[model samples]
Target chain A: MASTDTFTDIRGCPSGARPLHRPRRRVPREPPASSFPTRSGDFGTGARTRTGTGARLRNPAERARRQWAVSGWAGLSVVCRPGVGGMAQSRGMTSIKATSGGESAVRVRGLVKHYGSTKALDGVDLDVRQGTVLGVLGPNGAGKTTLVRVLSTLVQPDAGTAMVAGYDVLTQPRQLRRVIGLTGQYASVDEKLSGRENLYMIGRLLDLSRKDARRRAEEMLERFSLTEAAKRPAAQYSGGMRRRLDLAASMVGHPAVLYLDEPTTGLDPRTRNEVWREVRRMVGDGSTVLLTTQYMEEAEQLADELTVVDRGRVIAEGRVDELKARIGGRTLRIRPTDGHRPAEMAEALAASPVTGVGGATADVEDGTVTVPIVDDDQLTAVVRLLAERGFGIAEIGTSLPSLDEVFLAVTGQKASVPQDPRPAADNSDDLEGAAV
Target chain B: MSTATITPPAAVRGARSEGRIGLRANLRHISALVRRNALQIKQDPESMFDALLMPIIFTLLFVYVFGGAISGKGHQAAYVNYVVPGLMAMMGMNIAQAVGTGINDDFKKGVMDRFRTMPIARSSVLIAKIVVEIGRMLVATAILLGMGFALGMTVHTDVLHLLAAVVLSLVFGASLMWIFILLGLTMKTAQSVQGVAMLVLMPLQFGSSIFAPTTTMPGWLQSFTDVNPLSNLADASRALVNGGAVAHSVWMTLAWAIGITAVTAPLAVMRFRKKA
Candidate 1:
């Protein structure tokens, strides 16, 4: 389906099939945006099955169990992205009260922007509450940056309107600029200036008096822990320090709404935590935040509400735990002491109570059987039956669904690896120190 | 949840306090922007080198290489007196190009986004850019004229006429600045800005009566050179400094300055608004 979407451009171009023989120029080498090779199942065999690492859909009962994952709804786990069919054209300001039941600090309605033929943003509607963090999560080219740019008044939207901090982005941009601060993906400070000088420059640009600007510069330096290196040029600062300074520069004006676009993309774990701590402190000060991130862990750590966006639309949105539950239930992993999983479901099903739970499905890989059970009682039943059936249990643990699993279940694509986005570790000093 | 007013920090509180800024406060912001850009240039020695070195190199090449031929052979003073005004006009245009490429760099690095979100006057950035260009022109003019004096370029008019010549060059530079702003905001890259500078400014500088008077050129070339704003600016400066009749060129230069500005200022601002 993903390949056929591009058939006309390559084969039917004015140059014809000759271009097909050449390597595709614009095809991203990294299997970008929405490409998942091993997600589909066999249509030839009558029984449905999902094919991936450790997934075996041979038996009829086993295939039926995996069918539970095949959406009772749109069911786009294997191939297509969510919201390709269900995206609403407009959810005007009235939808805010209906959806969130409160006034949002930032409200977006049917925001659409296209770059050439690619729709970078397609009718995206979202709401971030006052004094709360809304994490916008998506893969590469998912319009996360576009949404941030629109809200921050940096990039104009081709269609629809966005209201940030009670000011319309189009008509009241100057007022909105006063009420919001933006920290983009790249740090935009003057490399020639010292950290203290950079903050002072921003303070003055914000129209603070000389005395106030000087005091604010000192205050920000202390806040970001850059006092030791405050006199050094920002070009010489470490990646973490520079990121902190970029964040600190944005907070100089005390913006009511702050837009952080992938704030911790290249930071080490410790530095990322430092940035997270500052964000928490800002929220404590009653500032609403719109944070965009690739790491589900970061979203889980920071976002009060999560909006999982894929291909320019929100696919799933809820608290982390709620999103996990909606996508899939908690999973149970048990490893037998005899160094083997019970190969056949028949032995455990007829003699034991493992099949009692309606939607429970188990896949045994590497001598560990992982079961997605509906609730705790079913978990207890599965545990008791595993030992009772003489499957000597070496390890027994219940693992709640993580945001990573939720992302995969909803988007159908594996989460891109977060650490070390670049091969050369030259600009950022602490990539090796990234632990969280 | 119901909530009370959230306390803002010092800078934001200042922005909220400003209902309508008076002219004095607006000037303050304009001056602040000018000062910030001055500091940026001060820190960048390469900018200083370009400002000081480029004018001297061009002046020496024109005066030494063409001074003998433009005048009779080995006649330095006549050509020096004749060509300094033209070099100053070129200096003004180069300073204008600096504004163009500098603004382009600001846009590419996303620094313009930071400034657009500030509560200061929107016109202050443009005003500061013009002010900085004038400053560069003055410095480059001083260096170029000092070299001209050493090579025996004499000032026939009093200090008042000389100061007026300086003012005239600045006005023309400011006019070119509005056009540069349009070019800077419209183009996507700094390299494109340079490309435009070569295309538009190179002909304006070299095709005018800087090295030779209009009579020396062919009839077809003379037609375009007659109305070229650079020609009028160079002619006005020449008449004021070298003791020629000043009426015709001075009025033409002022008209070009005002006309170019009237046409380009709003257009540049509109383009900048769209780009922002």
Candidate 2:
């Protein structure tokens, strides 16, 4: 049966196709109290209740739209509103697009897969709206790659369902494969073929005409800045170049949805930024992206909404700012003068009326005393109390919690580098060794 | 880069129908994959070393080492005509084994994942590998025929008969590949695929009539050779080129080809689908 159930255009075009240079339209904002549920109900109650409601909806598209509406509104109201923070204001434009009720490009619910005795994906649920990136953040062996593999139809899930771009991953894999592109964790380019040949081969396999395939190959090679090495074998290319080629190969078909499984895992900062730029450009061109990464910076730089997964389950899901905010608002870091000890300062701050009754705890680490402050009043009160106590502050600053801190708060464990027993033989040794 | 100016083609933008790949598109996909595998061989010429060298070494060793012993003192030239056609069967079996190793190596690399995720028909990948290996087998047969001629062996029948003999070997060779392809898909690594293939190939190669006539063998061994597909292939090619009663052996070889393919092709596809 020809099912168009998942076919919803982001631009609201009835035909599901849009012109290349059409003027961009502002996302239609839904009222906070109408379509969206309470923010705390969606994110604060943990992954189980949220996933339970999502699973109860029989239609995956309906479930995806509902979940997207909830998370999208939460992300927008928390980050896009004016006067929130300089960081949120700077990112407000992207979050606005993220909040649109665009069709879900990928809808996965109650996904479960087991490899032998280990559960690779334990009842995971995710939704990615058109023209936005949903970052699946997890540590190694956290089922990130398995989720990507299952959604891309490379691996079948043991149970549950996934629908991508109007095609069910299990029943309609061929149709799903037509609209989705996957750049796996390992670069999947043909090593023996030249860069140009690799792209051309993929173009042809994607059902492009021979002339179009050749033209698309040239266009992708030029776009990725691989024209200089177009004729060289991919095996001879550097790690970054091979990754670019793999990305280019996946893009030759201009798939409506792209899955990037750790696209910049071992890349240097320069290459990582290049990948991020490519991802943004694709999103700007009206393609939905589901990016899986272990790097917080990568997720922060690309994902409009983040889904934190660990040990085969979704631990937390929201905007990056919301996740950080959930841990607790900005932290007040105080470094006392060289003569005073941070431990004594922390003890005094903890005992003071300003911080004691509010339940904001103060802790000392590496010569700095940090207090989690909920508002500007707490910040001012702490500063006044410190001055009244005759404390000499050498350095003081208020900073938002890093993703590392948020990860620790949620997973209750640091996102440590996974213990890979193999030597770093795959790529450039510079950043890979540092990453390990 | 400004991808804003670049849009996907109209075919991609439109509502994609739930269409199965037609025969024409499947043929195109198979040809494209075949070109890819052929290009790999072109880039790494050493991959074809066995196909080129094995026939030459085997032809010389069998002709000189066992010619007089097997065919009697003054009849070495007769043995040349006898063993050369039989060696064609051997060439087919050896070249077919490479298909399994090549597929296992692709599985080890990330390229297999790419193939699996593409919208093309899954059988296209295996068919392309078989096509390229069959091409390699033809090349080895040509080299074996040339070596046989250089060693003073002559074809008694017309070139049509000699060509038929070569085609028969390839038909049998292509069918044998599905078995090895199954081994490649099920085995963990290329080394293990080779190890298991060798274990299966040794007895089949020795017990068959590819090296000597089955008439001189023990009764029980002859009974085994009566049913061995390799022996049927060797006997068929011997009759086709040396001008003998060709109907029985030729029909038996074709039947074995159909039977092996019928059993193994579906099994290989099932294994390929479940491999990940």
Candidate 3:
């Protein structure tokens, strides 16, 4: 059974918290970010010292330290650094690692596969630790399905190698099949047979006797809440029910390693959440899973590590926030309250790293200026410098970097396939400008 | 319902999950598959209709409508005796091809993929399907024989010869199944399998001596009947059930059985494995 605490923690943020910045660079009397989950602010030492209400007025960083300490999995480290221009950027890289160790559940290196003239997989590498979820994210026709097929031993790679549950995929596929369970994007349950019969058949195929297979089938039906529908043919079941049955079929063997290919592709949001909960429960029980999906939010919510693939190759891989932070950091927008010269606003930002470098553009229009900041301290330095210049700040809010932006930052463009050669080159130049 | 989660039974957990479980286990797996497919046919009204109704309908229509015209007046019993064995062989071939069509449909539907990913023997699927088809053939043939008995057409040969005829026809039909299996793996859909089966198997049935003796056919058609395996199966059946020279036809049919398996079996299995 899955603990409710993991689901509550998984709701952290689609994009994580904004790293608060204090320009003075003072280490507080006590260290922050060593405890429990915090909601008020980043684990900034004495950053939110004022302006908050009574309860929030207490040390927000101290609360964060307590929450993280109790969680025992997520490592929330706050590192503030000053750049070459003497502008401080306070950044928090929050990485969620699973609580299991030792041998990897899945490991692949330089796998190459080809079909006629089409290269479905070309030199792809992945590592999924024991008892963790590794989300493989890619768009349609991006070789995500092909990679899953190769790793699951359904299709042999033309080159390189893969190891699933300590068995070589190419030479020991039968052994690999014994330890691993695979649920394809399409449900593979028998349509004419009742759901109970379908599960019973799979159980028997996996070498269970008649009585044991029947017993296991009943357990699975009840666990998935399909007890009443167990006797009905799978053809009559809804899409979600069929998917649950397919997933249930894979679990009947008690597989140590499981593979799910776009598991919730056609499900509604509610059904998709239920599937997510089941996956979390499986992970909580110490089973390793490698899931391929196109949903960015699903990856953010469930995956401890993510591998973003595009065009048969891995483009980016890391924890969610690390990947987000790798792309130009969050966007910081400031609308000045007092009207000022465009030159003065640009001059004030010029002293820091946001002087139109690293994809940050400062637009001075009608006494207001907006600049993109790739670092937390850049925001702090800009805030301090603007106050020093006697420029009243009207509105200031930081936009957290999303997966779409991270995808764009790494791949340089979206998943569209273009045919124009000259225009593609021109678009690539603009892509470099847009990507930090 | 208090957390009765899935647990691998001790009987299975103690052994290697994908180990070869011996001939008994393979037979058990194959029987499970055959039983499931048998259930599928039992539940499907279309399959039930084809199994029980079509044989009786075809028997009566041919023995009554074509009987008088082909055998002349007062010779209907002789025609019935001849047509019974011929229709039995034809029905076996027809049903075997339909099994191939089912295999093709399952391929398109991802059923084959589901079986392939499991930790069981790969041949269990094709083997189980063949068993179900042979079972259907036996049931259909038995009904046809019973209808013949009702029509006052008794077998001239003894029980030993009649048994040989039934077994020989079954072997020949199983051999022809290899061809449709190859075609099923090659074709795209069940409809295409039917189209190709008609184009290929129907000509072999009609152009041969299934309806009338090949000795009375055109010179060119006689050449095809001489070589057609359907002609061999029909001739072997007529000799055993109707009492005639059986040695030459039996050898020729056995040769066709070996020749078809030698050619088509490898091609079908190669295609299945190459897809992996």
Residue-wise lDDT of candidate 2 within A98-178, one digit each (tens)? 443456778888899999988899888778866667889988998999999999887899999899987899999988888
Kindly report the TM-score of the first chain in candidate 2. 0.65
lDDT of 1 by residue, A339-426 (tens): 4444543245334555544333334444545565544466567766665666676554444355676676556465322222221122
Clashing pairs in 1: A269-A434
* Chain A accuracy as TM-score for every candidate: 0.64, 0.65, 0.65
Query: What clash count does candidate 3 reach?
Result: 14
| DockQ (Cα-based) for each candidate | 0.20, 0.37, 0.29
Q: Which candidate, 1 or 2, would have the higher lDDT against the true structure?
A: 2
- Angstrom error at residue B50, model 3: 2.2
True contacts kept of each: 0.36, 0.59, 0.36
- What tens-digit string does per-residue lDDT give for candidate 1 at B148-205? 8888888999878888888898888889899888888889888998898889987888
DockQ of 2: 0.37
**Could you tell me every candidate's TM-score relative to the true structure?**
0.76, 0.79, 0.78
Tell me the tens digit of each residue's lDDT in model 3 across A75-194: 324321111101111222212222222356798888888988777887787787665678888788768888877876668899988998778988877777777777876437778888
The TM-score-based order of candidates, best leading, equals 2, 3, 1
The most accurate candidate by DockQ is 2
Q: What value does the lDDT take at residue A393 in candidate 3?
A: 71
